[model samples]
Target chain A: MATSVEQPQTLIYVLGVTVIFLASALIGIMYLAQIDISQEYTLYNIQYSSTVSRMVNSPTCFALEESFELPEGYGTETQVQAGIIDWWKFNSGITKVCSDGRIIYAYLSSLDGTLQKQLLTGRDPLTALSDSDLESIDNWNTKQEKYYVLVYKDSQLIPAILEVRIKG
Target chain B: MKKAGGAFLTELLLATVLVLIIAAGFFGIQHIPGFSLEPEAKALIQSVGDNEICNVNLLNLIRSPNEDGTLGDTLITSYLTKDYTVFNETTTNILNQVMLRRWVMNLSINNRVEATFGDPAGFVAVPCIAYVPLPQPFFSNCSFSEIQTGFDGYEINFTTPDGNVTMEIVNQFVTDSDKIGGFGVYPTSEWTTIPETAIIGEPTTINDTLNADLLILQIYVGDESEEVLIPYELTISEPSEDPDGLTEVHLTKKDLVQQCSIALNLFVELNNE
Candidate 1:
């Protein structure tokens, strides 16, 4: 009879311990999963910003070139201004003029959403990212939009933005 | 049965120990810092938050030509003239267009917030702040005077960037239970009453709205009164289109470039929703 009583007590103890252990394991797994997700998102943000900065500041990209009359009738001097997009240059595939090895897929649009032009740099992602792949929830990707000054034709400067989406 | 029970207890103990070891190892790995993003990655993230984007946006905006084919001098003109209409319109329109997230932009002159454009509410998370260095505005517009109301006490009057402010000593306590004497703030057009509580040695604060941005006076009515630092606001008003003779209404390029040195702060928050 004493043995039987001790067996139930030990069983209860073991049951309680198992419950607590399982609960802790579940919580730990959830917490670690959260940390992983956050870290990935942070990395994606860093990558997106890096790519956008490269495109915006690089003269070979969409940066607008300004012309000014030099002193003493030195004709005219033209130089690239960072963060200013030239519409003509963008249309002429300026990115293709010089390959930077890095992949970029973006769209430039007017602030009022009037005009939108697709920008692609590098390859593979074009073939890798299918319509179904984009819709998949598990697909890792980051998208960000940044503002820029769009120089239309050779005169008008309109406010514009670039939206970049990256998948890796 | 006794032997079986003992075996069960031993197995439970072993399981507990194994679980603890695994948990400890997992947690230990997390603290090692090897599983994080690289330093360059972190810096890039920080720049993305504020610096890189803000600098690019602000510079482009400043360089953009206005309606009259003049370089964007909105920030300078607004600070000098104190007419935020054009500045607000330009910044608001562009910011709304460019920003894909919620943000607040504050134009500060001498560390004083002159103009704020955004709803600074609800989103209380950490903001990515971008600070753009500005030329120091000439603080040539400050005046001060003291008027003796009675023998024991007097009133101090001063002008700041915001407006005029007047502070007077309170000779009598508001209530018998009041510990320390406070100031009666007559803020030019408004009357401000002081709090009736005090901590024996500390100076009493006189809160007024006249120059809320720049002036806050704390008067200690004790033996050998304490001298407080008086901060003056910038007052050299440049030219604008205002008909009021109080400010110079004509803004010149030279004045805008040389005189106006108002710093800009862009606080951006990614809209998680």
Candidate 2:
């Protein structure tokens, strides 16, 4: 065979192909990495005001049944009176896990400069969820009767609601 | 020797290319899970919940009224309609006005959902953390339901296709109850003696031709974005010394006046209306 003469030509072809291939590969890799983060995020807010109007015309049952009453330290006049309590932030996430392996989580977000709250404990762990139990609090199921699932990101108000009950 | 060296270099290049291909495939496969929509969508919801919390809380604080003259009920109505209530007093006053910060609210609703898809019927879905208040006892089942007077619970009505949830919510503020002692239920044009109970003081009713003046429990609802244009109603009933003020501080028990009958009977309607 014509060994020496063909060697350099073959090397040139290989070099050209390799360059194009690596370029395409890099583009594909970066595109894949960004796919999950591309979509616009919608925010779901839950707010309340000392002003009754800022509170929803109708509150979720958990709060209403509780008579809008809070503990002395839970940010009320009594708590402030005690002079021990300091600041307060509208909280969201897991509250308590029932004995029956049910989970409950609270979701509070902002809407039109007011606090609007959403509460739920959804089940149905993603089939893809591994046993690894990652520390993704924003993600992950609690131990209460997972009821509602808020589907959104960050914008103005809560976006969508999905049921989170674990069914057979 | 030169040929040997060249072959070695060729082998190294081939190995490196192979490794590159394997690594790319591995990483490419790892990304498939992230592409799935559910987890991302859920995370977005969680983030939205987190992002808006601060704004809502601040809004709540700004909208809350102070003790000097701008009481909560007044400022809250003002806030509903977007009326900016400027702090008339200096910052020192606000900081010193400890009563202004004492306000808190909680929520409780009677959630009635009729489960149809092979589940139990008349199932109620009540959420407790929806409280606007920190300490939650004030908002009880009675208050929300209008069943038990002091916010006992909610009355839930539900529908299916799109579950129409009708609930009564109880929002409460726990002031220093002890300070609000001896609130004489004197017959202020709005109260009356419950027929049998002899009022300690001579009862006085609004002499004018008012409708339902015998009961008084004023409730007002205003469009939250506008400050001035608000709609409210004053209700009055057999007025005698009654629990006019709700305070949480320490106070001497002068003499117990009256109590809003554990009945949610108070409604807002005027003679003209």
Candidate 3:
């Protein structure tokens, strides 16, 4: 009779543990809700500065998009005249393209999957990122700041990330 | 007692999680991307604005009637133009094509910097357009509602109370790519140089900035070159607005920097890396 009573109590303990795990996971998702979406890019076919000048003289991109689900719809990949929009759309931040299209990802400092109502901030990253070394990791301050990293493989955008906190 | 302690700990964890969520909502997301501007970039943007201001001042040098009827000695003599005729628009376009034909006009290093901005004809006071609506028969199959001119890109005209007023820009161009190294001119008596205080330099490059001559233009090509006009006498068109509708009439330096930074940054990122 004691053993039978103990089994019911243990079952209740397991149920409580499962509920706690789900709640904790939900909280984390909510905390890191926003994705600083950037572009997955490839090198331009033309000369650098000229491309930049011509891009500035061109019209603004005619469309906007919002999605986090798979096969995420970024705009049609076309060459622009090397401007701010190009920078954001072609950032190879976190999730990268693999040889066979499988994604090899890294941790980005951001809240995962929780934002709704994404706004058009229209902030340009290049105006701030003038001289930062692209290939280094130390430039990132995981505590005070984080880089919103965009990743690309085979010249395609995958998931991006931003470091929210660094554990010492 | 042990069970009560576990439940208490669980409650504490939940509270912590709630705090994290709220903090992220308020502060965390915005700072990540928007605050990335470097000090150098800010300085460069400011220089670009400075250049645009200098350019606008040059336009004010000619004696032109203000929005009021009073005369002001601005670089632009007047915004008043005759209503554009189809033929006049065609001729002006052809002239602009010739005027804009890129070539190196030479100068000695000591030549005075000569710069001006606006519709070329407005400064020159050339009467080019006259009102003549499409005569009698309209072409059934055509896209030519109005005769288009090359200078149209440089001009933006809108109607105001006294009469129709138009504004335009005249860009200085270095035509020959090869001779750019020693390309220059010695100031002649005809070239008018603006004061040192007013100079439109390249926004970012120290090398590009100078008390260089007020930039000038020459129509080495067509008869109608200096005669292009855009009249705002009609009431259909709406006035242009800034990116944010918070203001009227002027596009602030902050606005251009916002535009240029976004454009050039994207260009560099996409084209180079």
Candidate 4:
């Protein structure tokens, strides 16, 4: 009779342990799901935003800059204007100076569909690799396209779109 | 006692195995593609995309090139010509390449909507707004002047004795005669006549000289009515060339406040990621 009673008590203890384990596991999964969701896009977005900012604001990129003669013994000074694309510089591949060892392709097109320019900067690792190699990595890349960039051409401010594709 | 102990150990092992199997299944379901956190991830992406478009993209689209002129220029031209093909196509083409979201663009002139692109029923949201002033239209030779003068030596003949009498004659668009003829010239092409009312008296018949460049206002002084004729000459000359470079009316900022402006709105819908 004592053994039978002890058996039922041990069974209750096992049931209690299983319930606690399942509850804890569910909570752990919920916490991990939140982190996974945020981690997926946050890093990509940060990199994308940074690349776009540098491309538009940096003089070595497509930014418009003007040179003015300085007075006295001072040398001429250059002023870089943000949010303006120098049409001549853009067409002349001056943007090649913007290559900073990363794979990026910047495309610009006038809203009127009359003008388009594409520049590829950085190393072309994928070009050298075989198709099978790319497929192995799942062909990972992030693309961001923005509108309302002003292209300064012939004393006119032309509206345009700039698309940047970053390859990982 | 040994038998009971053995059964207890077996039952504990079985319970442990059952819990492990359930946990494994739960984890497998979570790892399935798009099964966990898809809605949250989608919402975040959509929010970022929309914010960029509102802050940066719409501004550029208005300033971007459309054809022989900027996109804003094309919009104005399209507004007047009723041919929105160029503006609509240029904008849609640029946006289509980058975005999959459905959108609608509304162009309002002087607070009144003049052109709309995209289906009205497709999307609903507060639009991204941008304003572009219409290019000022140039008129070579156009003049407007109003000369208020009193009737001098002109006949003041009113047949009414008592009560009130009023007469008004408005001339629109100065004709050749009004331009070549001297001060009393009236427009013959477009003339607006006000019906005269002579209360408590017969219909007033005034002389042609009284009708020339004159507006008669008869006021009642006690029982007796006194007639007064005021002379005013308004001269409006049509432009020698096209009046408004874009349209027929002379372009003025005051007139344009309600009729001619390029106000653009872009309403975007969230696309499934």
Q: Which residue pairs come into collision in candidate 1? A: B135-B261, B239-B248, B239-B249, B239-B250, B240-B249, B240-B250
Off by over 4 Å in 2: A1-9, A12-140, A143-168, B1-8, B11-43, B65-273
TM-score of 4: 0.45
Score residue B135 of candidate 4 by CA lDDT.
50
Q: Candidate 3 DockQ category?
A: incorrect
Ranking by lDDT: 4, 1, 2, 3
Looking at model 3, residue B177 earns an lDDT score of 25
Write one digit per residue (lDDT tens) for candidate 2, span B111-212.
Answer: 222111111233211111211221113322111211112121333232211112232322322222332222232222222232221112232323322222
Give the C-alpha lDDT of model 1: 0.52
**Predicted model with the maximum TM-score:** 1
Instruction: Supply candidate 3's per-residue lDDT for B85.
Output: 37
All models: lDDT? 0.52, 0.28, 0.26, 0.55
**Best-to-worst DockQ order:** 4, 1, 2, 3
- Candidate 1 C-alpha lDDT tens digits along B1-273: 677677677767776777677677766655775454344344445545445666677667666667634334555566666788887887778877787666677777556777888767655232333333343343443222222221113443433332344444323112122212121211112223522111012223324333221123342221223432233222212122222212211111112221235566666664342
Q: Cα deviation in Å at residue A153, candidate 2?
A: 34
lDDT (Cα, 0-100) at B265 in candidate 2: 10
**A91-161: candidate 2 lDDT, tens digit per residue:** 33222321123333333332222444433334232222233322343355321111111222232122111
What DockQ do the predictions score, one after another?
A: 0.14, 0.04, 0.02, 0.15
Candidate 3 local lDDT, A16-56, one digit each (tens): 56665666677556644643222211111112212222222
User: Interface RMSD of candidate 1?
Assistant: 10.5
**Tens digits of per-residue lDDT for model 4 on B40-141?**
565566556565555456666766654556777887777768899988888887667545567777888557777788767864343678777655442111
